[model samples]
Target: MEFMMFCRMLVEISFYYSFAGAAAAHFGGGETVLPALLLSVCYILCELLEKHVTAPSAERLQKAGRGESGGAGRFFRYLGLLPAVFWLLLPGMAPADRICFLFPFAYLAAVIWRKDFTLSRYRQTDVFSTFWKAYGIFALTLTIFGGSALLETTVPAALVTVAGSVLLLRALRHGSEVWRHRDYQLRSLFETGLLIAAAWALSRDAVLELLKTVAAAVWNRLLVPVLTVVIVAFSVVFTWLFQLLRYLLTLGHREPQDIGEILQYFTGQGEALTETVVVSDDGSPVWQIVFFVIGILALVILAAVFFRWLLMRAPGEEHAAEQVEKIDHMPPPEDRKAGGIFRNTPAHRIREHYRSYLRCFERQGGTRLPSDTSRELARKTLELAKGTQEGEETLNMHLGRMREIYLRARYRQEVREEDPAEMKRQTSAVKKFLRSRPG
Candidate 1:
């Protein structure tokens, strides 16, 4: 289940990067392909490292230490703000861009300080929220194009639309919480509409620029008005579509390189005059192809979901309800083992239960050091049980015998002359006693 959740987050982050890349291309004049792919790969790798390596190491440090000042604090501080610092320190980052990155880092620090530096306050949702906000900063940094360009192009409008979508999605994602606040939906809708309306105004100017660049032949007294209206309508529709796409792609979760190409696309930095002057009816068809591919991708997702549902069998109601009622009852690893092929071997299962019983011994005041062997731990645990209750004495005797059998099974690789029935009985008795203990 944890692996599945991680995979889902991975997919969502990939889509989010893809969407952000596309938006950057359309509004800020950048290449969407390679940078998006690179960022997605980096994000997934970082997440994998953080979860599997860094987090576990920090947890071990916490276990061996006595205070809140463990590796976890240092990990959170660096993990949360390092990217922001990297972005801000990058050469040629606009002041607004630096501010964008800086604001989030500052806010996170403040929140952490307010919470007494407890990293647990920031959940996965908070991470997603911060990423989206950083995207907004990048989106809004289009003002670097020039104040006039910002007003005349779709950049400002795109910023507003992105902001609205972020807020609206946040509300949707926390619908139950929003429901507790009266007029939350109304306020969100009203704010979103106002931003979109602002976007529509800038979109008209953007359409004019797109028209001048793409279909200059359509520039006549009669058709100019009609073409402008049509292009403006198209821009609005496309903006909304892209916004919806971003929201959907990152519905569960939610980069800047190649500024030179973006600058060229926006400021005509290296373009010949003829390139902008050439009028062709090629725009709509290319857009259609793009939309077609997106539609196909959506259909594939739906099919995947459908097939997944078909393949997964629903648990029986009685078993499902019992599972819910006894949520705290974590059965042994073998009992909850997966039904797939290549199940863990009997030796592996025995090792798991052996470790579990060792943990039980530690809880009962037995000290098992890191250098202690399995046999050593078992012997030390039995020593701790000396002069205890009769029930504990019997349980420890069974545990000692089981440990010897496990040692032989693990190391000797030969069947013992002892009865298999007695071995099974002793193993079961030890497990039953461990589960019955309060700790």
Candidate 2:
């Protein structure tokens, strides 16, 4: 599940970079690498901040049953983007072009930060919906920016989109039991690849031209007019609101001040505030320097505190440890001498015998690491038995038989009627060998 989630995130980030690269290519005269790299860096930073900082804090708060809101953590997360904003500003580009470059990065960051990436919380429909939206944006960007001269940019973007789609499909398939087979996955990929190729071949020229024409028309006829009206209406409303606010601020203080007088007063106050903070003409403001220093210190302090808290064990963990210790010290069931009590179904009986076998092995000083699987443990035991005694083949046979029964019960969810008897026989043979070994 963790692997699948990581793959999904990588696919998302790749699509975002592809779309950003296409837009940067269009606006920056075929220069896509630097802009795409910047966007990718910003995006990855946001994900790290969310995963390591914001998420853990939220989880801890919830666990503690605190009513504290996550607003502060969220604010800090956004604050971390200030350096990226300044980096974008450092480039002397047109305001419109800079905004175009920032839009995809900002949108990607918002999408990633807003969504919880917990595996259990994932929904297939939501993931696919987000993917389609990103793909549409990439296609639109390609259509608008791609021309005969920019085939280099278009080809890379197309390849990235295809790769992302394949990975996302693989993740989807991997999450399901029915479609998890390698052959099934390869078949799906092949079908998707063919579909993408056919679509590209059929729509490479005519469809692209059609889309560009429609986009141009919409921009000229619909978007421009609507934007002009909105700007004009906003200006009028803003002026009215300013006047009302000024009136309220100066109410009963003076008799009907002129608009020019109010503006002059506000400007004077702004200058006063600026002069209070600014200590030099050719350098940054003293307050600005102080603010930067304080922010850095705050970040360092928060990180140290967070790490220290993480190192401390929780009460629940201690309780769980105590419970495990108690279980480890408990006496074995008396039913073990009676060939064990089998209950419920064949699967249950087989599992019970397997557990008994493990306990017996542990009592004989055989350790089972948590990372060892059933088959792995069986192999290790077989190796030990081979080192100690004769009839190695007999011991190997017994272990292999028990391993097969355990695996069938555990994974295949299949237990035949004879599985209980077979499991008992194999387990007894293995345990008998262990009992004969010198302590």
Best by TM-score: 2
Could you tell me which residue pairs clash in candidate 1?
A: 29-262
Stretches off by above 4 angstroms in model 1 are: 1-50, 53-55, 61-73, 93-101, 108-148, 152-439
TM-scores, all models, native as reference: 0.24, 0.31
Runs in model 2 lying further than 4 Å from the true structure: 1-27, 33-44, 62-65, 79-83, 92-97, 116-146, 176-439
Q: Number of clashes in every candidate structure?
A: 1, 0
Local accuracy by lDDT, each model: 0.45, 0.55
Q: What digit string (tens of lDDT, one per residue) describes model 1 on residues 132-196?
A: 56445644565565433432332333344345435533443442454346586566546544644
Which pairs in model 2 have colliding backbones? none
Question: Model 1 misses residue 432 by how many Å?
Answer: 64
Query: Candidate 2 — number of clashing residue pairs?
Result: 0
lDDT per residue, candidate 2, 139-229, as tens digits? 6665686543444445444454455455554455343553456776676556545544543442355655766799899999999999999
